[model samples]
Target: MTSEPVTLHLTVGLPGSGKTTLARDLATRTGALRLTPDEWMQPLFGVSDVDGKRDVLEGRLIWTGFRALRGGLSVILDFGCWSPEERWAIRDLAGLAGADFRLHHLWVDEEVRRARCDARWLEVPHETFPMSAADQDRYLAACIPPSADELAYAPIPDPPAGHETWAAWAAWRWPSLPRLDLS
Candidate 1:
């Protein structure tokens, strides 16, 4: 019996770098599920303070995505995973689930990204977080793009000395999370 293998489409980019657009397109093209936390946050929870609650909100959505992937569906997580540690964590997740992984790391110039974000805010006020160039700059400043090897599932370097990584903390946060393979 041949079981279908699945892929995890990971988005890595600044807040306004077209991650969701690409994720939406990938989902439509591949018939995969697109799990975008920002979209969920607006509906489920009010947008009083979107940034303050994002980490918690995204954690839930990612858990759901993992469950979906386990059920044999391709998932596109449009979470704007900005840091290399964040990407590595999800890459490790794909590894655990035996899913093929792809990084859709969108790169746009700051000016262009800011313009796109302003337009998006106008187009979908409720659907998108209000973004400013300053916000985008902060996000881009913090981003650590994956090296070629990290994107390729090659052994990645350890986090810097004395730097307590978020991924390390996540293991504790979701201690019961299990790896799954349908095939």
Candidate 2:
């Protein structure tokens, strides 16, 4: 019997870049499970990134996404995913889960991003954490846009040095994620 293909949709962007809006839309259209760390962080701990908690939460959410993929379900991870290494690792994880990977990169003018962040904070103070001007500037400077090859879904490159596999690297990167068994 032919089985349906599973997919992992990853959203990449700085805060206020409309990643969540796109993720929500994709989830509704595709019936994919949407996982957004911000939505959990606020209610769970009342703050974001306290003592590296966000990393822990993201690790668990990724594991959940992996399980859903293995069950032939699609997943959307609405993470800013600013770094290239993080994106690569997530793509590798999707491959391990036998799922196709798609990366969505959203971009907006700095002024517009700032304004959006301001509006979001004002409108839903409880739902979103406030983003300071310095935080926005730092995040924008640090964001690494996906290259053409990456967006094309090219074959994944080897894991970074010292890591035997992408799973190993992911375990190290997100300490909360257990080393996935390849068997």
Candidate 3:
């Protein structure tokens, strides 16, 4: 019997952009495992991204997601990857794990985004971190929206110079993820 192919879903956006909402919907619809670092960060550390802990946690989540993919289970990574390079790395890694990759890029008006963030903080104080308008502005400026080529799922470009393979680059990018021969 042939099992259905697994997929790796990526959510890309700034804070308050509804990444989590989209991820939850996708997970429910597809029975995909959803991995959201913020959900863990706030509950376990009582804060987010302090001293690079979030990065460490995300790395482990990515590794776990890959394992799920290998086991023929679809996974969703609810990470607001601000950099195109990070998105590319994850997409390529998903391919290596024999999973189809989908990138969900969410965008919203700055004012709406900020308002949503404010409301979320008031409603779920324990589940989220407070963000000032300034913080949203800064994060918005830093986020690099996916380009037309990316949205089209164009062939992935070669890894940045000196990186022999995407798996190698991924291992470097997320130290907790061990280099593997997923080919």
* Backbone clashes counted, model 2: 0
Model 2 vs. true fold: TM: 0.95
Clashes of 3: 0
The Cα error of candidate 1 at residue 115, in Å, is 0.3
Worst 10 residues of 3 by lDDT: 1-10
Which portions of model 3 miss their true places by more than 4 Å? 1-4
Better of 1 and 2 by TM-score: 2
Ranking by lDDT: 2, 3, 1
RMSD of every prediction:
4.4, 2.4, 2.3
lDDT of 3 by residue, 1-183 (tens): 224469999999988899999999988888899999999999998987788888888889999999999988999999999887889899988988899999999999888888999999999988799997778778978999999989999998888888888778878887787885466
lDDT (Cα, 0-100) at 164 in candidate 2: 89
Q: Model 1, 1-183: lDDT tens per residue?
A: 223368889988876788988988888788888988778788767562454566766766677777787778888889877677778777656766667788888888878888888888899878877866676677778888878887667874564455354345444443433322223
Per-residue alpha-carbon lDDT of model 2 for 78-149, expressed as tens digits?
A: 998988789999999998898989899998988998899999989987778888878877887898999888
| Residue pairs with backbone atoms closer than 3 Å in model 2 (clashes) | none
Error in Å for residue 34 of model 2: 0.3
Q: What ordering of candidates by TM-score runs from best to worst?
A: 2, 3, 1
